[model samples]
Target: MGKSQKKRSMRRHNPMRVPDSHLPKGLAAASESSSKTEAILPIIQKMQGADAAERKWACVAVSNLIQNDPSTRRLLQGKNIVGTLITRLTDSEEEVVVEAAGALRNLCIDGGYDICAEMYNKSILVPLQTFVPKLSTTLSQYLDDQKTAPENAQKLVYEFANNVITLLWCLSETSNKALNAINQLQLVPFLISFLGARQKIPLATVTAAAQCLYVLSDDNPPAIADLRADGGYIACLLSILQEPPQDEADPRTGTLRVLAAGILRNVAPLPPPSVASALDLDAEIVLPQLTPLLSISLTEVSETALQLLGSAPETEKPKDSGLKNTPKSDHKSPAEVGLERLENRLRTVQLALEILTGACATLPDPQPDVLIDDEDDDEEGDENSDDNPDADMATPEEAVPDSREQTQSLPSLVTPLLQLIQPTTLSFPPLAAPSPHPPTTSALSAIHLAAFECLNNIFLTLARDRHANAADVGAVWDAIWTALGLVGTQTGLGQEQRRAVWEAATGVLWGVATVSRGIVEPKPEQVQALMALCDGATADAQLRVKCIGTLEALAQNPAFVDANATIAVYLLSMLPSANGPSPAGTEPMLQAASSLIDIYSDEDAPWDINFRSGGYLARLQGSVDGIKTAVRAIDRRKEGGKELRRRGEEVRDNLVAFIKYRKDLGL
Candidate 1:
């Protein structure tokens, strides 16, 4: 207790102050690569210079150069730029601090996961954390006395708070170490304070606060405990999430509401009796709370996407239609407005889908109840205490899913998630590319990625719901495949985005096949999509392996007979001509053969007419030697090759056995 008191007093005395003498005492390592240091060296020098203006602009220059430009971001990272920006977070000049924070935040997004982990590794957390206590003080001032600062100063403080919380959120999302540091710094209470006095601050700042808290609350026992202990905390989040009357015209309302719901989704308790069994949870008390929270998010996700579509700038084609566009006040161009609206809508839907996913998601098949002792009444001794440093913080490993079940209302969300799976078109007549190519960054692709991921989780739960008829299953399957086509065909997509979409989409198929089994049936077109993915050069080798494995899983279902037969016919038809332009890889054909064998392994399984009368087995028999050649032709050292080879050979044995079985019957 005494040590904690001393530490708090010391922090209070120097909440955000870092002396020049202590500035050099940091963990920024030496340049790992100096090749590009010469180019970015000037900005580094200016950042360290005594002139505050130069330092501020130096940060601004790095931020601007790295925005949406990966090559420039990489060059900057190699130049000790991240370390220099960390030092500037403690700059004496306020403008320099804000600009430096902005630069660091952009570095995280532009450089992605590696740079965020690098920033945490370089000890950026300590300096960045000092701002939270300081910002908390400013927030307290806003609650007590709004006139503590002039209006300009208050807005600046709001902007700084926004940048700091947002950067912290970004870091926490990417790095486990950063999350540990944030929890140790006792940041959640301060973050939640922003939520309490939200209306007294900027909505953007509140959104940032909500986002940061949402990230921290995910499966963190201490953070969840803190949120639950303070009833007002949950109240504030729920208040922000409560739907406003339709006439209210706050432009940022949708984002704020969804972010609050995300925090709720992260921190809420076990889903009620409706999700699975009510044995563990207090159903009467929990259901009312969980249901309304879900109702708000589900309503918001669909309504928000609709609002985004409606927000699109209607292209007034004066040339083709010979009608003058309506006069309007001049501001940003329609293209700019369309992009902004789409981006905001996607962000809202992305956050909301996370909540909807949690709402429908269940705990994985139970493991040993290691964390709880059913017979022991000694839980009181295990309670988190004030002296325990990590009482509230959960390690990344400990941050599991919490209180996510949409038992009652999950059926309502299928239409919206499926709708989101497809791309939303914006009729922007002026978004012409300079070089007849697509833009580097795309929000439409991102929206589908989020939707695809949410649907992946939603599928298992939906599959278990016997009330969801065949049409629902078919629609869900169709939407997932359609979204894959849209995202897979996206021009100018970066390799990373491509991998993410395929992973999410394939995850939906593979996860459902693994968990749902006979409850769900796959379509023939779905089979075609999987085969295309397995053989496409665009898909990395590992994902192609997964595609074949998923195809194998789907083959076991009785409803999968049609898809299996369709694939078998397609493979046999393409085999003799496979050496041509088509990419009928050996692995895909082998998996199809395996699926065909598995389907026929069941006695009640019906054979396709092509198999019965078309002498297909004999033709396939003729291709057996070629199949062996192709199997041997596959590079054994490629990713997932060992499993592929084993599965392929096993499939060969099955094919041979099935042919012998048919011949024995004199087919």
Candidate 2:
């Protein structure tokens, strides 16, 4: 019977079942969520009961039950618990309401996008509208009376407000209706009130406020307008940026500042001087205020800041070094302490990377343009600025946002980014037996993705601008090559993250290779690895093109001529025969044309180059009829790209040059 059935999803996360002293022992040990009805059913009954205390207990129980356990989420959700929880939002018991909100929020986390969508469809925003605002009044009372307020009362208000704000963020993230409700209900100003309080409000509540604003304001016009119209909201976010990223354990870690920057970043093309000064924001002052955050975020992590991730955690010792070693905090075990340190480091670094990325608006473009304005027009060493589109590194067209130059330490960031994205062997570095918990594969991949994106912008910029100092170009390219070839080795890596890495890595190698041929010495294995990708028909189209582009980029340097020539012959085989119909997609055809042109098109290239001089160019000449047939076929297709057509013409012209050069040599 379906009643006796258990969900596969729940079974997987049964290992994360919440520990509760009051739970039935049999239910706690039950292997399946369905079999644990003895435990879960009572909580549902209690939540639907008259006693407020039991209902509160049940609300917290559901929250604890589903922390990371999705099976239980599906089971409870199937039981219609969300609707029951919704009713509690209007329950007379404030404690029940708070716990209920906490439960709904947990469901949002455990159930992911689907559950959040479910909650929204159930009309959660209706009760939440009237219920959520009351939390602010309680918080306001606590804010006014410091000594007179009971400590428990203050904690309750903080918990209630924090949970509700977080719940709203989860809700708004799910659907357009909820997002519209957010602006209509004027939640931005309410959240701004807490964030602006700064030191006065609990950091958790402030973080909740910051997080909600960060989510709602991103790419949402109404929310962005709400944030923009409220100058105090902007100030609240800015004030956080003004402070240094604080000690992790110390409540003031600059997470708020990071979120603040994100919110401001969304409000881009930031109003003109009037927006900055006279019209909108005091941007003249806002501009300098932004520098401190960037300066702090961009600086390489200090030895002390990153030491925990390197070495195992040890307890604090007394000055005399005679007393038994005291535990660092609350007698925590080395493993526990090590895990904490690792988590803190990952959290800090990822947040910093986000800020650095945001400062440049690094998304969607290979060459990131700064969205926020910089006071000075200091181009530094960027010889190929916006003026010369044909310059090795031409300026990106102005984005919708106000454009500025790269950050001061942007180029120098290569070393730090390189350190974050190492080969698999170095991923878990040796650190005694109990290693200071190495980064999880997912975390490492995420860091690699962000780091590579940063590198891509840098390399592409440097390549285009003809800036020679591509800090550690060899190491950067190696990391990128490793990512490109990671599918077989690291199965845990996400495709999207891997694709991002490839995009960044290719952009990086393309730029570095463009600036100078030999900066990244070409290895035979690297060439073979790239060729291997092009060999398989089942390989990704983008991967194939990127692989071909990488070979072409490296071919510019003489050190890679032999390797490039080998791939050139391989690509020549794929060209359509003069008698055959051309392939529908021009990518492979265009890629072949582009690579052939880069090689044979340079007539003056030295004899050491294997193109015509080494029989490879003769091979191209033999296949010229077939290649032209393909180009003609491309021209015949309605959807054939202009660039593809142009590349075909160039290939045809280059082949003509090859024939003349051959005739002149009397070969």
Candidate 3:
């Protein structure tokens, strides 16, 4: 055969080569010519197509495209595709609605805060709200027919509800405006109702609803009030925590518990009325449930478990069965798996601790009885008196106890919190080289800060309780001290973490000083540590204030006063304009000054004379001048500054009185 004919034969016989006639006409040419805009335009058009199947396919395509490509998401956003998707949310075709909801959910998940805000601006909530009841009805029907319904159909219903709830959850995290939009839709009650114990909802839907509430109510009072009004919501959440899904190893159950605990934390600090209601619900029943969660580490598996299930094919058998005939696989034991799951949920532990803190703060104080005059009067005179004579008498204002002072004991919280605060070396990735100062690994640092805050709150509660024993007080103090020491030794924590440690430490110390009432002595090391913190140039302003305040509390003890006389001197120096102290610093600075004056000044003439004789008068005079200067510089027109100026004036007056009385004694 000729060479050219041989080559032609080889091409025709080769299995890998395709004839031009076998290929779609001009496909390569179309691909080379099409721009991204042209490519997506067809999908966008299909999304708005009249046919339900076309719209569903388009929505799924859009969801898949946006999930894998950021530019595709921005393209869709720029094209105003969300508006069409939102409209499809209420389509008569359930498949179309599911695909549209799924598409929007993907947009929210990938688009971040800006996309959420855009969705809010587009008024997505109106359509979302309209669809919720319909979705719920459909979900109920599918669940009711679970045995007979196609498994895929039931799964689609679950995804539809889950997607809507997840979208709302995303919106809730956007900003206050978005959160308010959700609340304004009056969706809080609906979401809470989904959590009803009798409601037979998918676990994913319930978990999503709980998380939505948690995010919505974070620092949001009105939403919290709405949740509080839901008759069984708190009970429902508490019940979930109390009787978690029987499968401890199920990631969904762990997630459900974590979400429930977080919701409780959000509800714990509601306004006094709502808080009263929360307390009345006996939500503390979950404390024991939460205690065990403290040791569990939160893992991403819990977060993505639903997605994993959704992605798996229904016909696929359990992977475990594949290994059944072979030697047993080294699968993690249930206990080990439980520990890992707990460790994954460290944030849940933090939330539980915070809830305990708020719960302790809400314990009601005893009401005082009104004093009535017992003077006897003639019957005729009593009858002649005004019928409501007490009305004209101005009532004496009752002294309100500090919120912290109204604490109740939660002995159950102590052990779990101590366990969390106890230091353990955590594994970290190997560093490039050993250095003099290594920062704390992020995971352990977060755990430490959370545990320390819990410890501080517990100590504050203990300090205020008149019945707290010396042993309990000492134990808390020791925990605080140990945690503080550990924090101090950690070389590489971020500024925020360090600030947290300092604040927590100082807070506990201050609580001890206030609650001890001279019963518990301040440790010398703690005193010195606080003094050093005050002197540190890198210390945060709030931390400095807390340190100074703690020192003031410590100075109340005569033993502390003699040992840390320099703290008084340093504090007094801050009172002057030269130190450039912030207005927030004024109160603590003045308290420290007053405390020192009380320590040094005397009722008898002897100490006063000796104070003046020792050249301390000049130092006191400098402080007095400094306070006066600060008072003049303050903007008294502002309410906060007015109080600070008033405090400065009071300090100056006290110093003037002490100086004048000493001068009058003929010093």
Report, for every candidate in turn, its global Cα lDDT versus the true structure.
Answer: 0.57, 0.57, 0.57
Per-residue error at 576 for model 3, in Å?
1.2
Tens digit per residue, CA lDDT, model 1, 145-242: 98878989888898888888877877776645566677787677888888777767788788778777876787666677777766667666756645
TM-score of 3: 0.62
Model 2 lDDT at residue 314? 52
Cα RMSD (angstroms) for every candidate in the order listed: 14.2, 12.1, 17.8
- Tens digits of lDDT, candidate 2, 1-667: 0001112122101111111222223423333634444456777888899988888878877876664344566667777888999889889988898889888877775565567677788888887787556766766676787776888878777877787787788777665666667668778777887887767767878877887877777667877888777566665666676666545564236556656766776676454332332422223333333333323222133233244445554554323312122111224445555444444444444554654544433223333232424435333322223433233332344322232234233556666666555434323222232112223333444555566655655555455433235566676676666555552222121233444465456556665566555456767887776666455533455556666667776665655567666766666665555445435245665576556666655555642356545666555556567666555544322332333444565566666666677567653
| Number of clashing residue pairs, candidate 1 | 4
Evaluate model 2: give its lDDT.
0.57
1-667 per-residue lDDT for model 3 (tens digits): 0000111112111111001111123434434433354547777777787877777777877775653244555666667788888888778898998888888887876665667778888888888887678766765565566576777876786777788888888887776667667777666766766676224656667767776777666656787777777546666776776663756554556667766766766666433343335453224544544556665432332333323333524333323423112212224444334434443354344555554444444333222233334435233343233444343322212221443223343445665666566544331222333211111133344556566565565555565556554336567667777766655533342234545556666765666666653445656777777777766623355456567666655555554445445555566566554455433355556665666576566545223333444566566666666665555565544545544554556665677887777567665
Q: TM-score winner between 1 and 2, please give it.
A: 2
- TM-scores for all candidates: the values are 0.63, 0.69, 0.62
